[model samples]
Target: MTPRTTKPQMSVKDFEELARRAPEFVRLEFINGKVQVKPVPDGNHGEIVMWLIRRCMQQRPELSLYPEQGLKVEAYRKGRARPDGCLAPEENFVGQGEWAEPGGVLMTVEVTSRDADTDQRDRVEKPDGYAASGIPVYLLIDRDACSVTVHAEPEGGSYRSITTRPFGAVVELPDPVGITLETQKLKDYAD
Candidate 1:
């Protein structure tokens, strides 16, 4: 049987209290009263996140990094978001509290899993959410397809720059955060 997709309706406040209090199972972001439970990424996704973190640490040791972490945004609604991994420019922002506040985020990454709906959520809905909140960079890693998509320069309600890197390709983020990504390492995820 197909798992039912409809989530119980919730007010933003109620959702916040419930998520903060829940003990087991992964919780997720609620948009317009709808709930979404993010998938627990497979081993390949975990490896890729670790590999990317390692590379970023080597190239930009000054930045604080977060993996599978959640952040509180939408202050009134008390909504939150947890990206697969993220980078913060300096030490002050790296702490135990929420980390998804707008411009405070230098970059956010999402490693696609086996679910098509989840992929669409990351590729479409997430960019909208991130861009609307002013996150400057969003990186998407698609190991199943061996590709990377970078979304930058938010305009209106969406990101202006969209670049895809296929397997064995190299892609570079713009200045300030001039980190070059090696797409080839992504292919090793398949092994």
Candidate 2:
């Protein structure tokens, strides 16, 4: 018979400690006690993220847009995620710790990367994690699939609604943003 083995799940404190020890140049996420390290984004990824930042800023000058901000999702499991872009009022993060809890976050955007694990997190785990944490909106731009998915109305550990649009189509964001994002210029890395 084969021996059974199990990986020890990290406590929230342990995850926080790990993040604190990690180098500033790297991006890290704690999902269900497992740590995921992401590489620095490529030019295409940065371009898309910057475009979103500009558009969001234009729409709501009062709110602040932060790139690659670590977010704490969920109280029990405590999933820690860093989105490509985070939109929130400045007050929410003024005196907070390095990681901000999801309560004050208005929206989070994730652009798919070359890594399969990173893509999976953006497509699958992050939406559920953010929703479970009560974050209002989770936006995923999947380069592999050439689509943008908006997940909102979090409830019961999942998003109650999801909307998807192709690369060239405009995606209409909900309240707090209420802006139609132009995706025509967002090119896939393979392009």
Candidate 3:
């Protein structure tokens, strides 16, 4: 589901409190000064994540793909996003609290959900937020577009480079990540 904006924007503190009290089944995020309820993953989403897990493990065994990792994003660690996958060295967040700083995160991934505002949230706002937070890369698996986008080289609150490839193409997640994905397999899980 595309995140629906709640009425009367709340402070990050209040949002964090509410998110803590939220039910286990619901996922929450704070972005662009609005509270967003994340969509539940469907079977396709699960398969895609699993596929990524296998690929990442095969290529970079030193790192682990952490699912739904709560990250402090945007300026001044004001925004919180639970990326679909956070790629970092093993045990990168061992002692962190609920919302961990994005200091050592190599990359953050998001697989698009079947929702109305995905383009706005994922394609536009998310990259800006992640870039501002200085996360090295933001990988967006756009199910609706049947494509994958790699956002890298964050400078002045935006990514200097943006590359998008079709599902069947070879996608390279540039330096720091240095993983080339054979996205042909992703075609099988396309929504």
Report the number of the highest-TM-score candidate.
3
Instruction: State candidate 2's TM-score.
Output: 0.89
**lDDT for each residue of candidate 2 in 67-122, tens digit (9 for 90 to 100):** 98888875454678888888888777776677877777889889888886865577
Cα RMSDs of all predictions? 4.7, 4.1, 3.2
User: What's the residue-level lDDT of 116 in candidate 1?
Assistant: 60
Off by over 4 Å in 2: 1-8, 75-77, 188-191
lDDT of 1 by residue, 1-191 (tens): 12222443866667777767766566576642456677777798899889888888888898866886675533232446778877777754555555345456788888887776675577776776666666788888876767888889976657888898797888897655678987787888954
Structural similarity to truth (TM-score) of each candidate = 0.84, 0.89, 0.94
Query: Highest lDDT among the candidates is held by which one?
Result: 3
Candidate ranking under lDDT, highest first, comes to 3, 2, 1
**lDDT tens string, model 3, 30-105?**
9878888888899999899999988999999999999998999987787899999999999999999889999889
Error of 2 at 95 (Å): 0.9
Q: Whose TM-score is higher: candidate 1's or candidate 2's?
A: 2
- In candidate 3, which residue ranges exceed 4 Å CA deviation? 1-8
